[model samples]
Target: MIAQRDLARAISAVENGHGSFAQAAATLPETARTAPAYVVGITGPPGAGKSTVVDRLIENFRSAGETVAVIAVDPSSPFTGGAVLGDRVRMQRHAGDRGVFIRSMASREAGGGLAPTAQEAVRLVERAGFDVVLVETVGVGQVELEVVSVADTIVVVTVPALGDGVQTIKAGLTEIADVFVVNMADRPGANRTAVDLTHMVRESGRETPVLQTIASEGQGVDALFAALQSARGGATNAARAVRFEVLRAVRDRAARSALAKLDEPAARAIFASLAAHACTRRQATDALFELFFTGG
Candidate 1:
């Protein structure tokens, strides 16, 4: 059995793409592959009560004798190189629960939705024997759509008065949602938002399920769970194969990019050149291209 400290270190190793952790993760048993845990992705615009919904889901999952792991992706503080990790604070009730493993990942400028480290963190949690894994992304535009590729079921949460859900549809998030959730259903425009989402789904010709909930009061959570289960049952093996291909591509790109950043002298030189170029109002891309072709 891996100790908690060791597990934490392993997670960090994987996040950093270190060789030892990669070996360990690869050596994990077939049972790890066959485990019944369902990965759920929760994403939405900031302040859409996503964390509240995740909290409710965690509570419900625990009540049903299931162990749960949560991977909360927080926006990085540029100056600090760290995350405030506010979402984890909201889930402190599960801190002492042995059945729960909650990790907060910093989304450090890996735009287009999730941080590279977030995916590794999920793998760590999944291998730690949790019966379920819930990944909450740093709710940033269409990038959050990346969650759809990783999660077995994605719950796209939205709130009322969000512009007829048109903005979300335009962002392409509405297409990836396996379950659409209109949280804070007590709000005036909540029902309207739900209806609009249903219409949008119908228009897209996809029979996606939408659920309304007052997450704060734990309303309609059971229906959401049921919908998720039904979707899981209907999920085909072919879809999983495609998802695996996408995940492999994502991991490969991230690994290559991480390798490119390890040049200490080159990194310093590049930064210094960029600073000098900025003072002259020159484009950094032009300088980068010149450096690339000239071997400067």
Candidate 2:
């Protein structure tokens, strides 16, 4: 097994785009790259109590004798481009626990509620021999459906008061969520939200599981744990995850190579024009992308 410190370095290299993600990743055993479905994505809108749910899940998993790694994607800082908050604050208690590894990654304005390198980071954690990987997204409204690309089981958490008609929801998160969780169940309309989610899933022709929870109080988490375990027993989309992983890696490298052209004299002229507002950002972006695709 790769050391956790080495795994952390590999993820850092990937996230910063500073080094060869391939070289760093190659330090792991070849088995680490196999089709593995040990990831569980916990995501929802802000204030859905996803962090607390993850904390509780970590506790349960550790108690069940599993080593857990967490990647909590947080909003980025305006100046430093780093995580506004690290390790979910609530999860700091586990800092001393050798069996639990938690990291907070800055989303850096990436869409789909995840950091650009979050998928690769999850794989790095897996390479470190963690039994389970929990990916928590930056809860920015409904754009979190991207979690499906990485996790074997995607748990969508929501609160009780969003009155947006579930029936009117379209081809989005509602259709992709493997499990729906209505957190803060002590609040009013908790059961109502659960029922609405159930009905919505049924309407979509899926028998998805919907559960309610008071994550802060650790209520109903046991049932959720059981449900997650049940998912582990079933077939997973490991083959799909592996395909996306390689595709994304290729695209990421291509983009980086294109960006590197900015230092070339020809590209510098474009940048000069861009700085003088002689051309629009769209023009500059198109120029760079053209260089990448056409080798111009």
Candidate 3:
């Protein structure tokens, strides 16, 4: 079994872009790389009680004798670049449990509700032999779509009375969800919220399960777990999954590299031209990309 300390280091290496996950993964056998852990993505709008739901799910998985790892993506502090609300703090009950590993990653203002390297972190945790990996994204409304590319199954969480349900529609929550969960079900508007979501899903012409839960109190979590089991696919479409992840990784690195060169001569020249209105923002951006890509 991989030590938590080493696992943490691997995730850090991935997050810092200090080392390649491909290299770290090479040490393992092919089976480990081709077969990934079951990744369950939990995403929703802010204050949808996502973390509490994750806390409840952890208990269920642990009770079932399945090892679980949680990757909680929290918004980063712009000043410090550290996680603002650490989800690990909410799952302290599992701190001493060998079967459970909980990690909190800062989204680094790259919303879509996930840390930049969340995909890499999932693979590393899979290598560590976890039976299930839960990726809890930042509840950044519309941006929550990114998790669809990573999770084997995505549970879109929502609560009662969310600004007339337009927030959910704009987020494309119904389209991407395999399962919909209305958390904080004890609230007065819970049934109405569930009904609204069901109607939306029905319009898509497929029957998607919508379950309700009072997550903070662990009520209805068993039904949620059972729904997840039924909803998740038996096996992922590996090729498509790889394409999404690899392209995103490449794009992320390229964007970071381009930003790092902003103060350099080429980038500065582009900025100066833009400042003087000598070029459209589009042209300046194109020139900057050319300069970065060509090593100008």
Candidate 4:
């Protein structure tokens, strides 16, 4: 078992683009790669008590003799690109638990409601021999669908009474959730919200459970944990997920190249020439390719 300081240092090195984190990850024993660090994604709208839910989950998993690692993604400051609301304040109760490792990450323009490195961090934690890796995302609704790629089970947490019209807006979330938790269930309209979610899940032809909980009080956490354990391998398609990541990386590289060209004088001159000649799409594409690749 890694000591607290060493684990934190390893994760920090990975986040800052230094040290042997990647090397360590690449050299992980085959057994470590397939270890049982069941990654669970807990996501929902802001103020849905996601942090509280995560805290309760840590307690439940620890009680079961499971060591857990958490990568909590918080929105970044637009000005400084630093995490705006770090989880250290919310999850301080676990500060003394050797079984729990918590790391807060800034969602620094990675998009899709996660830090670009979130999945890598999860992999590192898994490779380090944790029993569970919990990824709590920024909870920006449907954009968080990518969490399915990393988490074996996804629990969508929502509070009761999101107002009259918001339920319809969350249909996409309902579809991706393996377990729908209506947190703060002690609040008004808890049953109604649960019933609505149940109907949505039923209509989708899936048997996803809609559970109620008050995470702050640890209510319903044990059942939630059981559901999480039972729901493993529900959303993962390893091959497809790997392909998507590769495609996304290529797309990002292409996008960066195009954006860079937009500010280049040569690209501008080529665009002007193409426009002046009323060039066909293929002709303009060929010219642009030549400008960037063939250096024409």
Candidate 4 on 42-73: residue-level lDDT in tens? Answer: 88888898888899898888888888999998
- The pairs that clash in candidate 4 are none
Please provide, for model 3 over 20-56, each residue's C-alpha lDDT reduced to its tens digit, 9 standing for 90 to 100.
9986665444434334577899998888888889999
Candidate order (lDDT): 3, 2, 4, 1
Candidate 2 clash pair list = none
Residue 40 lDDT, candidate 1, scale 0-100:
87
In candidate 4 the C-alpha lDDT for residue 228 amounts to 87
Error of 4 at 97 (Å): 1.8
Supply candidate 2's per-residue lDDT for 110: 80
Error of 4 at 216 (Å): 1.1
lDDT tens digits by residue: candidate 1, 1-296: 23556557677776666755567565443344455568888888887878888888888888888888888887877787777767876687777888878777777776646666676677766776777888898875655566765688888888888896576467467767888899989999888888889888898887888889998888988888778667664563238537756786888886676457536566456667777764333555554445544555
**Best candidate, TM-score:** 4
Q: Each prediction's Cα lDDT score?
A: 0.74, 0.81, 0.81, 0.78
The sequence of per-residue lDDT tens digits that candidate 2 reaches over residues 105-137 is: 888868778888998898788777888999998
Residue 246 C-alpha lDDT in model 2: 78
Q: Please, what is the TM-score per model?
A: 0.76, 0.77, 0.78, 0.80
Worst 10 residues of 2 by lDDT: 28-37
